[model samples]
Target chain A: MGRFVSIWFRYLRTDWFSLRQPELKKLPFVLRSPSRGRMIITAANSVAAQQGLHCEMAVADAKALVPELQVQDDIPDLTDKLLRRLAEWCIRFTPLVAIDPPDGLLFDATGCSHLWGGDDKYIEDITRKLQARGYDVRIAMADTVGIAWGVARFGNGSLIIESGITIDALVNLPPEALRLEADVTERLHKLGLHTIRQFIRMPRTSLRRRFGQHFLQRLDKALGSEIEILSPVHPVELYQERLPCFDPVATSTGIEMALKELLTKLCFRLQRGQKGLRKAIFKGYRIDGKVEKVEVGTNRPSHHVEHLLKLFQINLGTIEPSLGIELFVLEAPIIEEYLPQQEQMWNESGGLEDIRLSELLDRLAVRIGAHVIHRYLPDEHYWPERSVKLATSLQEKPSTQWPIKPRPVQLLPKPEPIEVTAPIPDYPPMLFRYKDKVHMISKADGPERIEQEWWLQQGQHRDYYRVEDEEGRRYWIFRLGHYHDKIYQWFLHGFFA
Target chain B: MLPEAGVIMILNRKADILTELQSDILRLQGFRTVNNGLLDADLGVIKQAFPNASFPLSCIHEFITSQQEHRAATNGFLSGLLSSLLGVDGVLLWIGTSRYLFPPSLPAFNLSPERIIFIDVSKQRDVHWVMEEALKCKALTAVVAEVKEISFIESRRFQLAAEQNKVTGFLLCHQTKKISATACASRWKVSPLPSETIDDLPGVGSPKWHVELMKVRNGKPQSWDIQWVDGKFVPIYKTVSLFTEQNQKAG
Candidate 1:
């Protein structure tokens, strides 16, 4: 049997949910959910564990142990999703990663141990990397998956069993380490066979007759007498390249140079296949085993090295390659067909500068955020707010004609209520008090009766009036509902410049 | 023989004129140096308030209100100046702590408030840095900062940046600031005058301001009761009534 590694995430359900929310980590907490009309504790954090509270215990008992224990509902599905994501991240270390149910991952290291120096060093590298990202993990390597899983969960810290000694390693451990059913372990303890060494000494026929065939099968798997197939989280075949440095690179320039060379090779393969990447991730594994990753996205599928380099440049300053990075891995997770781009840009004096404008926009969007830069296109709605819609791209054209009516420079998100005094309900206010200032109206424009769009389920008709104050300031105010109705209200909405 | 000799003398004088023209062109292009203080292009808008000459252009001007109540009128005057300077092409950047501008009210001062880009910064330090950067951009016509009184050094830096970039700046100092000297082209205080109704009509007239030019770098201090009508500023009769407690008390 080849060497296999088991990664154990202790209290996985508790760790995964509290991974992002660190405040809850310090408190004695338990994650419970309503099942069969009763809330039972599913998992507990390190704090609650010191209080001697265990899983499957009633919430009443856990609370009795620690009165102020905080409780949250468990999300088993989300924990499974997080586990799958961690499995994907494990690919950065080795490709043959499989999900060992509940809280562990099994990896068939095989001949890959030499890459990280040896089997022991490989375990240390992965442990440090996972711990740096704030995950509590224990790892064990052995000749078989069963023994590795047993040692990882029950062994001291991390252990690598000697080759062909899997049976001897399990002899000292309790019968529970065999992954036996609770009742079977209890029955063996009553029979004065608490240790696996005592149980293995018995004849196979006696053990099989006492327990079932499943118990013998588990025993055989752990002893390396049985073979188990491992299914990797990601397929073994993917377009990826890895470069291990002889001497670590500490500066940004060195990282950029390495990145450029790596992209040159990767893009060459992509170009040969006529494929372009929509998303590219550059990962730098520091000598201390910490991985710094920067991801960039393009609006369109692109394989242009210079253009992709420009996008990556925006993220270069953010990556902190502490100590020094010893390896670089670049992966293109999203790719599409590459098509020739046309050069005709409509911006005045459009040559290289127009292309630079898009690059600048990308950099600016990265800095100030995406929502700040918006392109507007006209919508067919008569209501002013719905008259223009935000366009996702500059190339989008307005489907409807822009309203010729003069629109205010800024529209209030919500209409503010104001006191009004007018001769008639249908007319503009002769005097209005807004924010404790009275503006006497001089010139008035309309009662632009705008009925709500019939397609909308519910709304009242509004009559808008654009009135100029004594100071020559103009305001767009509207009266809700019918003017003749006593329940109608007036609101000041927009400003006219 | 004498006529030919006179023609040669005239040709030599023409050659000297060509050399003088070449040096003048070089000076305009900045290839040759000009005196530092003499390069201020401020006389253009100075004539608006100061009758003797006028406030300097291409420089930062401080606008202060006499009382806390005069903020709206001072803002109106600033808006009017911005529109005059911007004319057609450039946009004005107004950096302030809070947004108190009502766009519909801007047309009274003949300003199109829509052309102004408002930058609301929360921190005190970001205000100065953003203002300085905004003033450095040549594409902008002017930058107006509504910061709680800036320091003299910061004002000098703003003035120097404005002169270099040729973008005008208005520093609207609030009432809370200590009255100190700054390196600005000029400073003015504006107070609102009660509107005058024409033919005893019901509403107030165009906005009028009691403008006081407190300090002028290279011009005489003056005052004007100015009114915003049509699209230009015109002198109006001074009124004693100010918009104060009487209206609020009446309500």
Candidate 2:
């Protein structure tokens, strides 16, 4: 048998606004957003609702009805952010919490409510907590998700439906309680089917032909014949370890101890499975209902408790323990398959495969950032800047071999314009002045012309030259276009060692 | 004749004892010759200036640069040395503030760019920290860092880390405000030298440098004209003889 609970936030957006701005609790205001070429009221607080204002009503019309009505712009995605946060908090009540978008949370309360004494105390505890957080909620428990949702939103009488009487409880509900489309509900009402009780005895073939198979599916789902899956807010992390404190942990030492414990357990589990974590988060749930977290990423999959703990230790200062934390959870969101390697007799293993190398890189990344560390592989492109591509992983191999053409040891980030004296078209520069210093060329290489990849972008071709000065300092200089062209420029691109 | 032979043998033994004492002093100064033989880079006559006639592997070597050309020469020379030091699969760490070394050009020095990891840290302190960390890892063949400034204490820390593992370190100090004393095995200044093409061929040839060993803990401080060709260092004999003639006339 399955028992589910649904909690509806009647005025989620407005309640959040009032919580942020306490003055909005008494004043009549509505959240307005432009829709269909008009400002429609998206949500209204209870004060405005009592003043004869409702959702979907035009703001101008509402203003005409109530002169003292206040209109505030509605924030996009506010409902989603609010509901997700609330659902994450609701995990304290039940492990399986699913977000019912716009304003609700669905929980598979199966085998869970008994822990709080019974279903009644569980509901009271949830209501008191949400209400304390300034959310007005109506919650209902039933044997299926559909019945729970219907009872939470539109049902009357007892909120909890017994295990065997799901159909009896769903019969009194209206057709819209089945979660049918608006147009379908409108058609049903036109056919005088005001409630599920009115259409209870209808033939299955006729109902399928008239109202469609979706309506039947909903009806059957509510009656416990069809199963409805609820995807939880967080996917169950089998690699996660949790530690609950008897006395709230307030000191940094306590937090470290908790982290070490969690890491030890997590690494043990990972070792047993021959898997390792590439990314993990250390979360501390405080008594004040706030979660402080520190995250770490590794260049390679690792389950070494000391190494992973050191990575977290670098950022532990960022976590604030206000009012103390009661629970600590460490979750590895990204894991990879790993095979344990036997220790080598000699320390000849010095490359990407070395565990110590990866550990060093991980420490460097945590301290300074992973983006600053780079390894490059040869690319097929002829453009000097695009000739090398950054390797995304430690083990990535180059697709092409390094170009054999002589390239400068140090390449300027951008080509610097220089003054040049050349011998007409298609000839190397005789002399060049860069950074206010003149370089008289002693010997010069060919004007190797590299045309722009016209398919990638539009630009002029470059004629490059490897020129040596009297001091033996070589430079890779280039002409932007043909020397005979009306508009031409020379640039010192790089310095050859 | 037997007496004369005995005297010559005594003198040779005295010279060998002096060399041994010199190596002992170098070891006390923290310059460790891990392999105690010639470095794989084939540094030509340049090896004569190092203690035990071999490059120190487990200590810091500092390179001083003032101009862009000099920096380029140092990078090229470092890469050539690294190509030999880093065996087939050895990894190197190149930590600097900015990434100006073209990745594809490392192959010219006989080192695959893929084998090198480049770390571009914005702060000088972070670069030092990363260099020290990289030097401590036995898995790395060498660490090459270009920092704006390094203190005597920071350089000492780098030496300590390098000695823990037999990882070599190359520190390139560019445009530093002042040349501070450091705990390095050798101090060098590599400047670009005019290239010589084979058989009067046109255009530039192999990269060459006037490599100056300005300071060595217990060895000779000298200069050499060296050229890189076919993945090996070739001493320029013509320049050496010309320098000798000029020195003789001046003397």
Instruction: Give the best candidate by DockQ.
Output: 2
A130-178 in candidate 2: lDDT tens per residue?
9999999999999999999999999899787777778789888998889
**What DockQ was computed for model 2?**
0.58
Output DockQ, candidate 1. Answer: 0.03
Residue B234 CA error for candidate 1 (Å)?
7.0
Task: Estimate, for each residue in A1-497, the C-alpha lDDT of model 1 and write its tens digit.
Answer: 59999998886777766776888778898999877878899889888999998888889888888999989988768667877888898987777889877788999888888999988788899999988877789888999988888888787543888677778788877888778899999999999987788878789998899998999999998988889789989743365768889999999999999889888888888778777787889999988888899888765556778878877887788888889999999999988877444323323322222343344445434544454444455668777656656666644545665555544433566788989898775667789988899988877767888788979636888888877676556567888888677788888877553
lDDT of 1 by residue, B48-114 (tens): 3332222345688898854333666677677776666666544677777654555444555545444
User: If scored against the real structure, what TM-score would every candidate get?
Assistant: 0.45, 0.67
What lDDT does candidate 2 reach at residue A320? 95
Interface RMSD, all models, one decimal each? Answer: 7.2, 1.0
Q: Using lDDT as the measure, which candidate wins? A: 2
* DockQ, every prediction: 0.03, 0.58
User: Where does model 2 exceed 4 Å of error?
Assistant: A1-237, A341-348, B1-32, B36-41, B238-251
